[model samples]
Target: MADSYMDFTSPNTQFTYTLSDNPFFQKDAQNVINTLSINQLNTLGNVSLLDIFLSKDNVVEPHIHQNATELVYCITGGAVVSLINPYTKELLNFTIAPGQVANVPQGWWHYEVANQDNTHLLAIFDAPVPEVIFGSDILRLTPANVLAHSYCLDEAKVKDTLAPITDTVIIGPPASCSKQHPNGMPMQQMMNHGGMNMAQMAPGSYQQAIQNQTYHYPYRPISGESESYNAPLDHPFHPIPFLYRRWD
Candidate 1:
């Protein structure tokens, strides 16, 4: 999938990724990644190959992939992958450091964030068919009302906090990968101050939420404009999830 804009023969092997940018993901981590994909391995199957990733911390956020099961291997350092079981409000969690793998069933909500250094991990899907939908993109790129409604946050607050979804803690901004935003601020402070309140990835949430009414928003868009025709109410158009590929 190489275009004139993205040639790999002289690829920036420093970051082995090319083509397949997304409507919601970022692609500036070329320095930290070495991603290569094999188009199709077997007999016209969905077997796509993913190269190893030097996982970064904020890359962690809750997300779901619709059509595939994923297995992740931690090559170094450590990571924490968790999920809230919909049936029980308790979180099913795991601490994955070096030389270990975590298995996540498909269609479940999950997310992974790296530790202090350049933690490495390899992701292998059951069918080499996997789609990554970053949380920042989903929250920032989707219609404003949809973003707020999906997470049950006040619409005003969503706007005040999200400037076309600035570099989120999920993935560091352009300058560097540190505990701070390239925009200038500490990440823990950002999340603690509410960068990502609904951020939880316990891949194990295919079960329905318990009837507590304490968790999860009602996910309802005020009856109007079908959520498709409504424009960004007079704002500079920010191309969303321009970070990576999205199947949504």
Candidate 2:
């Protein structure tokens, strides 16, 4: 019988799809990623997923999925999913272990850092293909002078530092880098590290900052600002849109 309701492709003819066969992207030896989407399974074109494997301290660099909301499930070990809430203007960090999940709204800047070795995660997306903007790309693509002027940063320093980021860093802080913080954490934390449940913040403090447009964390307050705060709000490490040219 010809079914008018759907295409006549036979599901039985299509062999079982394996995640291992789909290679989306990867980093060094410590990080591996597998992707699944409409490209592989036509039946589930509206949804997509990423299988990520990382060693201790490895990071899925800060980026934004312009097209889809991501739901990340921790399959093994531990990790910290960090993102900013646009509505509250509050930085949120969730510690995720096996059986835990974290969600990142579409177009939000976010990143994941593995807290332990053999960390595995599955990131499911609402779209078939997720368009992303990596923080490293934004930093490298934008002219140093533009960034220096916009954020009042020194031009020379910006150029010298970002010169190394020539490509989209899928996973970062390579295992070879020996840099460490005084507390024994890797240098990854140097880029706006946030903690879960900021207890030191007084009640209504974040709300007030959101109202006044005076939330200052990593950067000094703009001139004429008396109230200053030093919270996890300093996440310039995340990707932000920068239009270089207009498409006609």
Candidate 3:
């Protein structure tokens, strides 16, 4: 009856039991079951393991997982995950089917919009506390004055968006959930975040198709003191070359 067992005592405590002891772990968990306590899961870095049998009408709103990468595996049903990278103005959307996987990068805003009917889904993450940097948790958990002073946003604005600050739970009342960016961070404004994407990249910008010359410089000693000049790869020094090019 128990494929695996975990005791979810709270947000940071747990006891673990495994079924097959398989390192890769098991997929298609609907036929079997396993559970882990919250404390045991705190050691889990950026992830939520879901065994969901979605009904005819199920919905997960637009949200971002803070400080973690999202890897969702569709077990019995497929889903449409939406993502927008504002800085680059690039968008990568998906409608993955059963047995397929979707990867969402860390700290970038994203959401998964499921199908119209029932489906089974499994979500994996790269963190133990999945919403450590999530918008809702940030808006709901921390003290407004502390966050406002740190972020440099107006305390009144922070208060309006993340009202009634308290520790946010993964599964909690919908009323407490806050917006992804209360100021409404639309895709067009993504450029402000400095996020990278294809649209923002100029064509052939990094292509090695053209040849370019690089210069290395030799530094003169300060009378008797030796010094080393360490330069970065993207740019180099060439003051000496210019000084002597017209000397002869």
Best by lDDT: 2
TM-scores, one per candidate? 0.54, 0.71, 0.40
Tell me the deviation in Å of residue 40 in model 2.
1.3
lDDT of 1 at 12: 41
**Model 3, residue 56: what's the lDDT?**
23
- Candidate 2, residues 24-102: lDDT per residue as tens digits? 5555555888887766765564677888998877788788887789999999988889898889998788889999999
Which residue pairs overlap in candidate 2's backbone? none
In candidate 3, how many clashes are counted?
A: 23
Per-residue alpha-carbon lDDT of model 3 for 1-248, expressed as tens digits? Answer: 12134344556443343522312212223222222223344433333454444432233333565445777778765666667776887766777788898887765666554453456566666554344233344344345666677789788766654443232222211221221233455322232244323223334331211112112223232233334334321122311111100000
Name model 3 segments beyond 4 Å from true.
Answer: 1-38, 41-48, 132-248
CA lDDT, every model vs. true structure: 0.47, 0.65, 0.42
lDDT per residue as tens, model 1, 171-214: 33322323444456545344433343322312212112111111
